[model samples]
Structure formats: C-alpha cells, structure tokens
Target: MDVFDRMQNGYLYRPEDPNLGISNTEQLKKQRLFNQTADHTILKRMFAAFGDGSQLRPPLFSVWGGQFVEVGRDVKIGPGLTLVDDAPIIIGDRVQIGASVTISVAGHPVDPTLRRRRLAFNLAVHLDDDCVIGDQVIILPGVTIGKGAIIEAGSIVTKDIPAHVVAAGNPCRVIQQVQVEKVEPKMAKSEFEKMRDGSLYLPEDPAILAEQQIHMKLQYQYNNLEPGDPKQAAMLKKMFADCGEECYIEPPLHANWGGFHTHLGDRVYANFNLTLVDDADIYIGDDTMIGPNVNISTAGHPIWPAYRLKKYQHNQQVHIGKNCWLGANVTVLPGVTIGDNTVVGAGSVVTKDLPANVVAVGNPCRVLREINDHDRQYYYKDRRVDLDE
Candidate 1:
C-alpha cells in the first residue's frame, strides 16, 4: 500500500521514507505564498476542494499545506488557522471558524522507540454544515462537530459532539441544546413562554400562530417537492430548531407547530405519515429509525370539557434517546423519555417512559423483555443469524 494510505489508516509511517521522496516542498511553497499575500484565490488553488465564496485570512499554518483539506461554500475561516492536514479536514458549508483555531490530524505513536523514529498516523476531522468554531479552539484527530453546533471559545474538542448543541470547556461537553433562547426564571412569561414551560396556554395566541404559520408555509413547500428533492434538507434546517446531519423525514409529515419545536439528531430516519405534535419540544436522538405511521406528540389539552372548549392546551417535551427503533403504528405520548437502544413494537401506544435495551409492545406499552444475547444470535424467533448461507 501507498505511504499516504498507511498514514490515513492509523498505521504509523516515517516522514523520511525514501520512496515517498519530497512531498512537502510544494505545500510549503504555497503556504508561504498564501500567508504573505492573503489572496483567497490561492486558497482556492491549494485545497482538495475549496467551494465558491469561501474565504480565509493570512497566517495559516499546515504541515501538508491545504492539500488534504476540504472547505465548503460560504465558509468564513479567520486568520491564524493551523492545520496538521496529514489526513482529511472537511469543513462544511456556512461554517464560521474563528481566529487561531488549530485542527490537527497527525499523531505520534505511544511507543517510545516508534516516537524516536518520528513515526506518525493520521485521522480525519470533520466540521459539519453551519457549525461555528470559536477563537483558539483545538480540535483533535477524528472528531466530528455536527451540523449547526457551536464550539465555545478556548475549548478543546476531544470527542465527537452531537448536532445542534452548544459545547464548551477544556474537554468540551454540551452545556445546552441550541434551538431557542433559555427562559429566565424570574422574567415575565409570555404566551409562548407559557407553552414552552408546560403551563396551560393558547396555541391561537396571535404571536405564536404567526411563527407557526411561517413554518407551515415552509413545510408545505417541503411536503410538495419531488420525493428525492435536494431542497428538503435546507428546508428542514430552516424549519426545525435543531436539525442534524443525515436526518430524513419522508414527506407528508404532519406537525402541529410545523416542527418549530423539534430537535432532530443525526442519522434519524422517519418513514411516511410520521406525525409530530411538536408544540413544546420533541428531541429525537441520533441513529433512531421510525417506521411508517408513527405519531410523536408533545402537546395535550385539559381533560375537562370547559377548558377544552376554551382551547386550553398544555405541552410536555418528549425525549427519545439514540439508536432506538420505533415500529409502524406506534404512538409516543407527551412527556415520555424513552431511553437509548430500545425497540418499540408495532401498534404499541407508549403512554409512559420506557427504559433502555428493552422490547416494548401493546397498549400502554409494557416492557416485554430486555434485549438479551439470545436475540443477537437469532435474527428472528427460531431463526439463527448466519453470516454464511
């Protein structure tokens, strides 16, 4: 295999390998020229893929120059950007990277002897679309910041952060989700505030309906488009408060608030006729798959007929954790927090909270059983999971 492949695969390779020859000469030359000139045209010429309207200032540093880096459209990269681009560094569209951000993909071997020989490996770092990296943030190897995520200044990102969250600290953790402004405890509450806080409120409040109607217009556009339309993603990003990467909701999505109160995580797939009563909030975590005809609601009304006639409604947030599978015709009720890696059977109504790693079915959704070793060995009842058939 080639030396480049060896480095990228996390197999250590020596920089002084004779067969590789002088690889850094051209990169170094371009790095010097770009930094001195600050001409964005040179940036376009340097990287693997530098999209249109992306700009970067001077004082950029990279060992392999910008050869392995990919910058998407309309990205604003500030000055003093440092890159150890031995592997790929992919920056997605509309990404705003602050000054003095260091992104490193190269790492030395832990073994002393290997370190003495200057053996190194590479792992790619990715910053997804619309993410903002604050000044002096250090992103380590193999870390992917998800779509619309914001990294606080002076933080060190050591792990992959989930989409649409605000993360901070030395080893960054998500301090808060990034959909709406936090309501102050002592502040005067509006009708919208009442709805968000789970108190009885009116959806017909003029201000609230105005925002919902805007989303409804966008949703109408989204639902009527061609099935495989490219516009769906951008529309979802605009409509939802926190819409992550690789999330797909098959059209004919019915949402009461038009997804104004939803936080969708990455790799989430929803089949046709998925309904979201997202009045307060609905957080569907990453890698969760929803079967056809599932209804997840966050809004409810009073049991009393008098309050119902007056259009009194209350909302409770629903939180579904990562890697869950909701079968067809399942209904997840308000205020329920379903844990990670759980499977909800078809035609089940989840009225209460369900724990992780269990199979739940039937009305009011009681736990059928915990996911066991036997289940992994068998794909179905009495059917073995055979690799070779």
Candidate 2:
C-alpha cells in the first residue's frame, strides 16, 4: 500500500515521507490562521466537517487541518485542544471537551528496529455523542469511546470504553456508571472545579489568571536571589505543595506553575537549568541530586493530528526515589518512576520506569548493568575512590 493508504489502514509507514511533510506543513498553516482569528464563521470554513453550533475555543493546535476530523452539533471545546488526525477523528453532538485534551490516531512502533526507521501508524478514534472529556485527557489511537461517557481528568485512554460510564486514572478504566440527569442549563463552571476535577476550564478566568500571576512573581523573585539567601528555603516551602528540609534547587529553575504542584522530600539538590513542566503533581524523594539541564515533563499530547490542532494536552505525575543521581541533560517524560540509588547517565531520555541500584543510559533509557562492588573500589576504571580521608 502507498504511505497514505498504509496510514489509513493502520499499517506502519514512514512519517518523514516528503509528501506527508508537505501536507503537514499546509495543514499547520491553516491551523495557525484558525487559532489566530476570533470569527467562528471563518473557522467553520476551514475544517473538513464542522457541524452546526459547534465551536472550538482559540489557541487550538491540530494536524492535517482537520481534513480527517468531524465534529457534531452544539459541541463546546475548551482551550488548548490538540487533534493528531493522521487517520480519522469523529466527535459527536453536545460534547464537552475540557482544556488541553488530546485525541490522536497515530502512534510509533515499540520495536526498536522499526522505530529507528521513523515508522509510525494511524488508527481511528471515535467519541460518541454527549460525552465529557475532562482536562488533560489523552485518547490514544483506535479507541472508540461510547456515548454519554465521562473520561476524567489526567487519564490515558488506551482501549475502547463502553457508553454511559465514568472512567478515570492512568490507563483509564471505568470508575462508575453514570446516569443522565436532566436539568436547566447552569452557569459557567468555575476554574477551580475545572482544575480540581480535571475538566477543561478557562485559564483566562480572572481568578485563575490572578493566582498564576502571583506565582510568576514569586518565581521571578526566587530566580533573582543569590545562592546564599537565607529566605530561599522558606520561599520554596511556600511555593510548592510540600517541600522538606535541606532542599536546594540551583538558580534559574523553571516551572510552568511555579512548582505549585510539585513535592520535594528532604535533602534534594538540583543543579542549574532544571526545568519542571509541572502541570500536575511531581514527587521527588529525599537526597535525589538532579544534574544540570535536567528536564522533567508532565505534559503529553495525543497521537491524532486533529487533536493536536485543537491544542489538547495531558499531564501525568513523575516519581523519583531517594538518593538517585540524574546526570546532566537528562529528560524524563510523563508518568515515569525511577527507583532509589539509581544512576542515570548523561543525556539519557527516560521513557519508562527504572528499578533501584542500576546504571541506565541512552535514548528510551535502558539498564546497562547493576551497581556492583567495582563501583565501590573504583571511581572511574582504576581511579580508586579514596574514602580514607
């Protein structure tokens, strides 16, 4: 099959194909204009299929210009939606999609050989009518969500869900069966509810924006202070959800929410340029030393191009155990866990979980070896560690 046919058929194909690149660029350009303009009339003319009374908020990110995306009537979408529509995305009537929600129909092969060839695949995603997709939810390829389903915030949907159920958690599962209760149209949902419940809510809400502004000022103050500031520790404790004693994060630390969602245990030390994309909770255990330029990200987007164009995103927590050392330029993706006493080599991209007391390295980081007796005697291959000071 040709590349485009393969994509539609869910067969692996090279995404770097020149034809695909050209198509992607054109789609992105259209999406850019769609996001910039406020006129609903103009947006309706751009999509492949847009139903009556369906409106998507601004700052939407998508792929393929919604050519393979279809939206039903009277659907209200929150900000920062992302549609990765390599295949097809079908959203039904009266749907409410929370801010930063991602729905994708594309995925990379797990096989290293195939992945190395830049191979990818696409599958269709269908969200039935009257569905509520909470904020920061990721709907993967080939998943068909049933009608009247509620996908809670921060969940990752990998499989099909039955109709009329509330699903939640990482690798989302059915939480409870929901019953439709008819009532009068209520007032706009509060930002706190959106953030707390994981539904798409407006960040532009004055209360929410005000809080963020205050946090930014605090971050600026922290970044500008000298290394010897006595009040630094107190500042950190106040800014974060929970921060333990003797923790030192080097200056120029960057966090999207000013580390408000992060929790650091005792005696943690992070070097310069430690960037935390802390849209959700991040827990770091005691004595974990983070090296320079380390990035820990909690946000992820769907594989579907249509979802990306809508700017939808999800956030997952990251856990790092005690006494671990993350080497320079290490990048940690969402929902990864690293066990205690582990050493990650420089420039490693941690994609999965790692157990304690091992040395891991490389892209999609894998365990090279267990920490053995040799490490005790030699610092670096015959360079003896002189502990007798």
Candidate 3:
C-alpha cells in the first residue's frame, strides 16, 4: 500500500517516501501567508474543510499545511497552535482551543529497529462538538474528545475523554463532570482597554493589530536578524517596556507584544527560546534564572464556544518574584504569581500560585517541599555548602 493509505489505516510507513507531503506548491504559499498575516481568506483556501464563522489566531503550525485537517463550523483556536496532521484531524462544530495547544496525529514505534528505519504511523485525532481544550494542552494520536468535554490547563491528554467531563493532568484523566454554560460575552471595551483590564478582547481587531504589528516587526528582527548584532541592548530596550540592567535573554524569544507588556528586574537571565505571550503585564523580579524553552503566557480565552467562535480573548498579569529559578520546559499560565526564592522543576506546568522558598513541580505545579536548612547544608548530593572553598 502507498504511504498515505498505510498512514490512514494505522500501519507503519516510511516518512521519507517521495509521494507523502503536499506536492501542491500553492498550498505551501497559502500556509506561509496565513501564518504571516492571520488572513482568513488564506486559511480558508489552505485547509481541507474550513466551515463558516471559524476563527484561528495565527502562527498556526501544521505538518502538511492543513491538507489533512477538516475543521467544522464556528471553531476557534488561539495562537501558537501546532497540528501534526500526518493523518486526518477532524474537528467537530464549536471546538474551543486555547493557546499553544498541540494536536498531533503521528506516533513512532518504541522498537529501535522500527525507529532506525525512520518508521512512523498515523492515527487521526477527533475533537467532537462543544469541547473546551485549555492552554498548553497536548492531545496525542488516535485520541477522541467526546462532545462537551472540558480539558483544563496544562493537561497532556493520552487517551479518549468522555463527553461533559472536566479532564486535566500529566496523562489526562476525567476530574469532574462540568457542563460549560453558553453565556454570551459582554460587549467588551476597545481592544486595548479590554486586553489590559482582563476582559474578553479580540486579538484580530484592526486597531489592536495595527499597534501590535509594530512590535512584531521588532520581535522578528530580534529573533531572526540579530544573531550576532552587538546592539542587542538597544533592540531589547525597544522591545520591552522596562528592561532592567544586567538582564539578558538568549535569542529566538517569542512575544505577542514583543515584550512591550513585560517588565524585568535586574540581573534576570533567560536561556534560549523563551516565549512570552504577553498580552498583559508580566513582571519578573531581580535575579531570576529562566531555563530553556520556557513559556510564560498572560493571554487566555472564554470557555464558551460561542465566545471563542467570535474570537474573544482576555489577558491577565503574571508576577515572578525575585531570586526564583524556573527550570527547562516550564509553562507558566495566565494570572500566576511565583513567590520570591522559589524554584520550579523541569517539565512542570505552573497553573497556580506558588509560595516563597519552596520547590514546586508537576503538570499542575504544586509545592514539593520548603527550602529549609537541608538546602543550606547540602547544595547537591550531600556536597557541603562551602562558600569560601
């Protein structure tokens, strides 16, 4: 069988097969434009089945340029969305997706021999109607979300979620039964005012976008053009509203307002690929060390599909206290506050506030332990803490 047929039927196949990816150059062009501009017309022409009143915030990442994704009517998705659509990704009507969510339809075998041959398989992801997928959620291959299911923040869904249930966690499970009421969102203020006040705003509003575009251009230049540019300081000043002295961020930084909504205290250091979805204020205190691939977001959306279909958005401030260390791949959600001298472990998702002088870690991050005298005595593996030595 051909690679496509094999993938559709859930059989192993080689990804390097010449006939696999989209041969249609026109679709590729549209995909590029859609990401660059968030243009609905380009998105409509790119996907397999895009229905009426559907809205997607762009920078949409897809494997095959949305060729295998069939999106139903009134579906709304937020920014930093990734669709690994090697097989079909079928979305039913009124699906609400949050920011930085990934729906991957492809998986690899565990066997080394199978992997060595560049072998992979595909199983389609199906999202039934009226489902709410929260921020930074990852849905794996062959999973089906039942109608009206609600997956909360920072969930990694590995299996099917039944209808009308609220599910969340590392390997996501049903937490409770919740039927999200379809309440009509109020007529929000001007987009900028609504954004700052944590009310539902549209990211695609013309005036809002016009102002955001200026910062986005600077952000693009900072990420792409300024690899070795010595005037990184100047660029950073232009990017952020309040960038403190001795603060350094490694390149490939992604920000919604180009860090204009963010304020940093002194001696703050961030590693590569720190993404700031700074729709609102993000205050980082002094001496905070952020590890690689950290995502700090201040943007969110309403759970109601009707609100989402209209592409309503909201923002909340994030506050990080002084001397805090966030480990690699930590996702800090909207409206979170991390206390001073706290440490978040690797791969943790901070969905709530963390108190000072503690180590918090998990999918929905919780305090592991307080930073007690044990920490003062031993730094690493019973090694004595000798400052003089």
Q: Using lDDT as the measure, which candidate wins?
A: 3
Residue 306's C-alpha lDDT in candidate 1?
100
TM-score of 2: 0.52
C-alpha positional error of residue 137 in candidate 1 after TM-score superposition, expressed in Å: 48
Model 1, TM vs. native: 0.52
lDDT for each residue of candidate 2 in 1-389, tens digit (9 for 90 to 100) = 78889987899898788878877676677777776675677556657678998878766778777778889988878766788888989998888887668899999988999989999999999999888887778999999999888888779999999988889988899989876673112223334445534353344544445456667788889999987999899989988888999998998989887888889999999999999988767899999999999999977776889877766566678989999999999999988999999999999999999999999999989999999999989989879998984
Candidate 3, 254-317: lDDT as tens digits: 8899999999999999999999999999999999999999999998989999999989988999
* lDDT tens per residue, model 1, 1-389: 88978976777798678754478678789889987777788887789989998877667888878888999998887656889888899998888887668999978878999999888888899999888887678999989999888888679999999888889999999999877343111112345667889998767854466556767988888899997899989988988889999999999989987787899999999999999998889999999999999999988999999999989899999999999999999999999999999999999999999999999999989999999999888988999998874
Residue 123 in model 3: lDDT:
95
- RMSD per candidate (Å) reads 21.9, 17.7, 16.1
Question: Lowest summed-lDDT stretch of 10 residues in model 2?
Answer: 182-191
TM-score of each: 0.52, 0.52, 0.53
Candidate 3 has which clashing residue pairs, if any? Answer: none
- What's the distance in Å from true for residue 339, model 3? 34
